[model samples]
Target: MNKLRQHSFLAFLCLILILPTLVFGECTCDEEEDGDRNKTEALKYKLAAIASILVASAIGVGIPILGKTIPALHPDRNIFFLIKAFAAGVILATGFIHVLPDAFDNLTSPCLKENPWGKFPFTGFVAMVAAIGTLMVDASATSYYSRSHSKNNQAQPVENGGDEEKAGEHEGHVHVHTHATHGHSHGSVDTSPTTQLLRHRVISQVLELGIIVHSVIIGISLGASESPDTIRPLVAALTFHQFFEGMGLGGCISQAKFKARGVAIMALFFSLTTPVGIAIGIGISNVYKENSPTALIVEGVFNAASAGILIYMSLVDLLAADFMNPKMQSNGRLQAGANIALLLGAGCMSLLAKWA
Candidate 1:
């Protein structure tokens, strides 16, 4: 009886030792096979995403440009204000709902060290700095252009000014050179057509830069992921995402009134940015690790900066400029329509955050 009991104990110990190896070995093999399958499916989805996103972006941007032929879509028309309001709302939601949270997640990831990343709110700090920097650039550029334009106007010979001065002198009144008459004022606010046009051009370019930065990061993330389950819904969400974003950008570009060559170049560049980013991700997927410290920091910083720029542009440049306009403020119906459109645009983009 003693020998039988000892033999039973020995068998139990042996089974315990061998069981883990057998289970773990089978799990490792299964995991390897699943990883391979996931990679294959991911590549197929990535290819499809690139094609679909590119087409969606092109169509979205094209709509605004084509709308130029429609009388109601003219910039001076009330309906155009509604469109701009909606586009601004989309951009605003993108910055607040989509990019800012991602920046926080990346900066505060567990993969990073706790010393600097965890101790301080680097995401908010970086975004604040970026917003300030954008303001500086915006002000500086506008000031510089205003000065240059003033110089050019001053240099031009005023053909009829001499006659007016003579006539004023003969009437026993001192001739006051009021630049307002020439549509270019030296002091006070200069709301001339030329100045406004230049401002639009600058705003459009800056807005594009912000949008492009965010688009690239998202594209790379989507491309680098090897899980079809993750990529599947993103394909649909991002398609809608790019489409609305393109409309916003297209509205800005149209307002800038660029020449044919410039318009085409800007349109094509915006259309291709996401696909190009995806292609880059595919090329570097073998070596790129999304959770690596370096990748996290870079992506986090860029996303924060982009969020700042987009938020600032949408609120200050796009919405404020139009919403505060005398025309929009005076018309009750137009104001109501614009407000409704803005709400709809923001609601749609915010909903997309669930899937994206």
Candidate 2:
């Protein structure tokens, strides 16, 4: 047993030391002004990617919001379960296959000093901590909202004993209104909307964190690179990636039942943040070093945190919530279909990791 533990510790330490070496190994010292000159050509193709992503995001997010118009897409239907499962799979793959791997690379890079980093796996550790933090936020926020909503229901005060019977009857139908309308369900009618909204809000905020962290890191790397050939394919890949990610996030926001203004604001934030990061990267390219110790550490820590939040949100709030629901459990065929869709979603996203 002692031998096994020691072997595990040494193996883990080796991974920590080796991984970051790969990430920072790609670094090239400062480039010339000609690097900026290459930007004009790169800009032209990137616009296409940006446009494609924006359109995809709009469509993905808007589709889920139209449950009223699309009967088959309604939350109660078996098809809706399949779609949510597929989405959850995509999110899970994003966290595990894409984001987590990238975080490991960032922290383990050769650019950073070896003494302390070589001793421990801070990348995985940070991700674990971040995931825990997100859970706390999700649970505490939901509890607070439920408590506030409970107060509101109590203050309404039943007008008469006759209305009391009506209230009881209305409560019976609350179950029907739940699962079909909100992304989440609550045991008590008073806490339903609050619980549902809190999850959506938490999802939107955390998803943004993941995308934003990756965007800035990639943007800086792109800005520092002099090779137009490398940047060309990345522009296309990242655009598609951003679009799909935005769609997943948008779908969650729509189901969250936020007001129209709130919805638009969130969608806009997701849309604009990456481009803004890219622009910032362009501005700071002179001072920015893709191989710098400080840059690697900052980017690694943030990426690890984002990966943790995204992984947890995808698995717990997105996948588990729907897959384990009574609705899914009651239907055997739907569960099978959803399982296939989940694999497809995860597989498709994992393929993208090759380029972007």
Candidate 3:
């Protein structure tokens, strides 16, 4: 009889433990149905985001590169400097305000295991490594190209060299006088201009790589989301984000002076990347869980790396190069104007983070 009583108590204990799960399972099913309803509403916004981003990207890129035909937007103009300052500020804020914080959030998310992710600051570590990698690429590419250029220049015959040198020198002298008449000098155009132009090309390519990485990820996140309220504001904010970012990239592309075909291809590529990513996200949304462990790790690392690349490029390649230009330094008014423009651009981008 005593043994029978013990069995009854054991069964009751099991019942008590299992009852909450049975009730909670029903609640979970209800929540899942509500989530589905919300997700269905969000689908409409994804379509809108595609169109908005495509148009915004095209217009933004086209404006600067095509605007080259405009007198004020010429590379030599004070207006161009201000435009670059604005663009640099945008890129800077993108790294700091947008991508970096996102990285921190994802890497430190509770979904991740606490053993490694919580124990170590992986986001920062990845970012620092990424920054160093970018510097290596920048330095190595510049060195390799510089060496190749010097070799090619050396390989030319004296006869060809003499004629080319004469022509190059004439062009350089003309450039100096032209800038001088505009109240500044572009430094020695004979040698530095060629090297500078090459560097610009490198910068454009690397900057695009960094920007594209984040762009695709952002698009995917947007596509995978099932919240209309989350996506709605992102649509507007990302639109502006792409627009200003395109301007930054366009500035570099314009300065690089790539062939018309190259520019067209690049512009198209940039415009398409995010939209394509969105399409991919939509396809995989059924299985794509944003807060899942694998997704968080991948997206977090990529975002951190991208942030590092942009920060490095903006500071070292874009802002520093222009701010230290002889022309900008010579004119105090221009310097002050550019500084204000930079602040305005950064402030605007930072504000967008609240919604995006």
lDDT of each candidate versus the true structure? 0.86, 0.70, 0.87
lDDT tens per residue, model 1, 41-140: 9999999999999999998887777667877677888877888888889999999999999999999999999998999999999888988988888888
Residue 46 lDDT in candidate 2: 51
Query: If scored against the real structure, what TM-score would every candidate get?
Result: 0.86, 0.78, 0.84
Q: Model 3 misses residue 191 by how many Å?
A: 6.6
Ordered by lDDT, highest first, the candidates read: 3, 1, 2
Give per-model CA RMSD: 5.9, 12.2, 6.5
Angstrom error of the Cα, residue 177, model 1: value is 7.9
Tally clashing residue pairs in candidate 3. Answer: 0
Please give the ranking of all candidate structures by TM-score, highest first, separated by commas.
1, 3, 2
What is the overall TM-score of model 2 with all chains considered together? 0.78
Q: Top model by TM-score, which number?
A: 1
Q: Higher-lDDT candidate among 2 and 3?
A: 3
Count of clashes, each model? 0, 4, 0
Local distance difference test, candidate 3: 0.87
